[model samples]
Target chain A: MKTNGIELEKEILDQLPAIVLAVDKNFNTLYANNAALTFMGSTPENVIGKHCYNMVRNPQCKTPECCIAQAMADGKVHSIRSEADGGTGNRFLESTAVPLKDEKGEIVGGLEFVLDITQKVLDEKKLNEQGRTIRDMSTPTIKLWDGILVLPVVGVIDTNRAQHMMDSMLNKILSSNSRAIIMDIQGVAAVDTAVANHLIKITKATKLMGCECLISGISPGVAKTLTQLGINLGSIKTKATLSDALEEAFSMINLRVITTEAKQ
Target chain B: MEADSFRLLNGVKAMMDSGDEYSVSGSVTNRCYIACINGELSSAQMGQLYDEIVRMAEKRELRGVIMDLNGLAVLDSAAFCVLRKISGALALMGLKSAWMGIKPAIASSLVDFGADVDDLCICQNIEDGVRLMSFQK
Candidate 1:
């Protein structure tokens, strides 16, 4: 069927999941689709001729910055993310407005279609929080002894991750007043020249704080790779294993770890 | 000398020739000479502070010198270079130098700027610096 001589498939518009509405230049609601009427919790008779802002209160509502106003002014389609208040409570909506013209191509009203993005927005927020938690957990610093701290690094080392590791290690050393730090990289997938350089930087920074840094858990492959790369860790100590590093740390702090005999 | 000692113990404010405000206050606590540095660190200020510290070290038996940088927010490369020179000079004079209260950001920046701080002893606070000095002795 057609509305006002405009070919509009009313059946398709009514079946659409998105909320569609037509509003005049003054922001008065002219036509509300089935989804729009349902979202407003009102019938077409009560919704029509009502002010759009009075029904859906959003940040851009009642402002010249509204998507519909922008589309009407520019005679182009505009889209915006709006937190709209509807029958289902406050929801995130991606609203797109297209300028509606007559036979003369003069702007008369605008058609706005809004997609509820509340779930998508919630998912994105949850994902961001999880990423932060993972970033923090990836660099865990633990105090192994009175004056020694150990950091277990697990994963691919990027520039950002390396910087984060450095920050975490430095802060831990400051708080713990530890004289030595052992970075165990057994879980590291691989190490390149860049990663080696970052490690050197960490050592230098820690030394400036009066903390000796020792790198441990160097696999045979990593050791060969370092030699091939000709990356000198300089004066920073390196150990083949965490056990050896721990022993060296204990010696630095004048601590001796001895195993006791089993009791009968 | 007595007035100097009193000033050193009570903390003295040294105004540079350029009218910049800085201080190098020294006090003997736990037998460790603690020098509290404040205001923006400059080479000239460090030079004056070094001369005063060396003169004082000549008269007194010092376990070590703890340079407290708690009042500082940013330590530039020039200041760090001056600090390295001071650390070396202090060592030659038989006085160990331990930097105390270095902020984490400053430490990170120092390394990022490629400052050679390996020869210098750094401590978390005055207590740790004093302990480190005693341990070294």
Candidate 2:
């Protein structure tokens, strides 16, 4: 009956999702279950009798505020987020350290349970990027070309939107391999020194990547603001309207311009 | 330090001075460089901080500004909006703003909040923040 009970306990421990490790008060590894060995990227042979910090390569071991150490000292459970160098690579883990006690209620050692959470973190990051993309798309000033790329703007440019525009434009250009980019800013509210500089950077980057960037729909107010900012847009080709910009872009790429009358 | 100078609460030092509170010391300048965050910066505090930073940009010529949030637990929507506003405002002022000392939990929270942290200069520590800011200058 005792043998059966031990076997049942072992089976339950093996089925746990988290890696469980038992360490002595001195931080020496006493016993690690199969999950622990797998998570620590080591076999039981190499892990046992070794210092937990040495086996885990945790820098916190040298610190007085080490979670495991604090847990052992206070005889309480301590939760901490730590990074570990798994055999594959560095991995982020959420670790909970619990003090182990004997039948007399005296603290003997600590037990650590770690759960890998790298995937969840990456997913969150990706979702955030997606949200930004969606927000950028909702800007009425932005116009999507070929239903894949966007070019929208008019008036004074804010640095935040400019950065977002640059990133979105670059991603679109790279992904779609589009030949032309048309930025229409007919309703732009204002332009300042910083906005002009950001525009210049974006134009230069776009052109360097073998894509032709065309500016169109520049309002008179924006032109005056650009002049006041001492920004020289002479190097960049701009048109008074989006249609003209598109026509210029098509001509540069050696594509014959189709007239609206012809399409009708 | 006097008892009133520093209070250990919620595992953080809350230093209350004469209408000013220094949350954490980033580095030692002539005076101890500290991050002054208003009490439990809610959504309104985020917007207020962003506006204050923008006003500072208009008044002084800064090469770069550092948004040190070592004292913050969570930067919610309003806080995230403030960061965005600061980034935009800095560009208008011909300056840069680097976010420094972002804890992983806060970083993850920002991600969860769908904040755009990509364009801004982010550093893990105050030292790295200073280094990056100087490099930009």
Candidate 3:
């Protein structure tokens, strides 16, 4: 039973997620747990008896804005968000210093807890980039086709996305000197009134640029939405499927005969 | 000197002198002054300055903050973000904030980088900015 209790205590200490360090009032390192050693990239032998600031190479210790010094002076808990270079690169860490008290409630030392939040910060940045990429893809703009632009737009067009789509498409049409453009929306779920107006604007922009924009892959539901939106598609060239759009685009640029001959 | 106490000034104008990237002038309603930074504003310096500004705002209701960047050749994104946050915090304290003396090239670069300056009141010169904030009084 005694051995089991000791093993349980060891297990709990090892399983703790935070790096824990105990330091003297002067900020000298007294003890460090396994997690702390791992975090600092050092062993207990090298860190023991050294000033914590010296070990971490903290330049602010000599300055007036030292949080550790303030905590020691007031006997209060202090927390700071700081960056540490852990041999790999700079990493963000949340460090908390709590004053240690003895039986008589006298301040003896302090315990420092360090938590690495580098992964969390990186994840948030990546998520933001992904959101921007997705928004750029959904918007009807020619910017997506800078290097042979291809848009496989699937789903309904609302007022907001439609406006974005028009802007993107017009910008691309003016910038790129491509002979033909293809917009495939075979899986589109629906279209609204504002969406129809945006479509008209896109067609007008393409005509002004002297480049042909082909719409293809329309579903039955999309066709119904188009009618309800009161959009006149009489002047716009469209195809039943993406394959049809490609064929039409090639023909418009006088590349159909050459491509057919090559295939044959 | 008391660690937290600071003199208040109404306006601050800084210009670079003799290899120094920053200089300060005018009354500081807040403890801190507008340092017309010509070069880099390192993270450490920014953190220290921000801490001082926060303390000053808490002690005395800081009325205005203006950062004149007439001589600044480069303004990094980190510095821009810090300024944005500081401006937002000052606004909460009913203090007016403006960034003046920005060169046309730097302004264009900021826009190209997609830095949101829409919330910030910007001026081409310090005098114009002071005039804009005069209504705050």
Report, in order, each candidate's fnat. Answer: 0.77, 0.00, 0.00
Residue A180 CA displacement from its true place in model 3, Å = 4.1
Off by over 4 Å in 2: A1-3, A15-17, A39-46, A73-76, A83-90, A103-106, A135-264, B1-137
Best by TM-score: 1
Candidate 2, clashing residue pairs?
Answer: A153-A185, A154-A185, A154-A187, A154-A188, A155-A188, A155-A189, A155-A190, A156-A189, A156-A190
Pick the winner on TM-score between candidates 1 and 3.
1
- Please, what's the RMSD in Å of model 2? 18.9
Rank order (by DockQ, best first):
1, 3, 2
What order do candidates take by TM-score, descending?
Answer: 1, 3, 2
Ten contiguous residues with the weakest lDDT in model 2 chain A? A141-150
- Among residues 3 or more apart in sequence or in different chains, the pairs in candidate 1 whose N, CA or C atoms overlap within 3 Å are none
Candidate 2 per-residue lDDT, tens place, B1-137, comes to: 55644445522533333224222223332221223443456554455566666665565555566666756666677766767787787878776566654443454345434455546665444554455556634
Mind giving the per-residue lDDT tens digits that candidate 2 earns over A1-264?
235777778777767878888999888899887888776779878999998887676677658767778898998889887777777787788888889999999999999888898887778889999978876664443334442233777444676777666666766664565557787777677777877767666665455333567888778888988887788988677898877887777675566655576654
Q: Please provide, for model 3 over B1-137, each residue's C-alpha lDDT reduced to its tens digit, 9 standing for 90 to 100.
A: 44333321211222222223322333453333354544566676666556656556666555566776665777789988887887888888777777765543455456446566544675434554565667745
Supply the global lDDT for candidate 3. 0.65
Tens digits of per-residue lDDT, candidate 3, A66-111, equal: 6556566678888877777877898878778788778998887888
Better candidate number, 2 or 3, judged by TM-score: 3
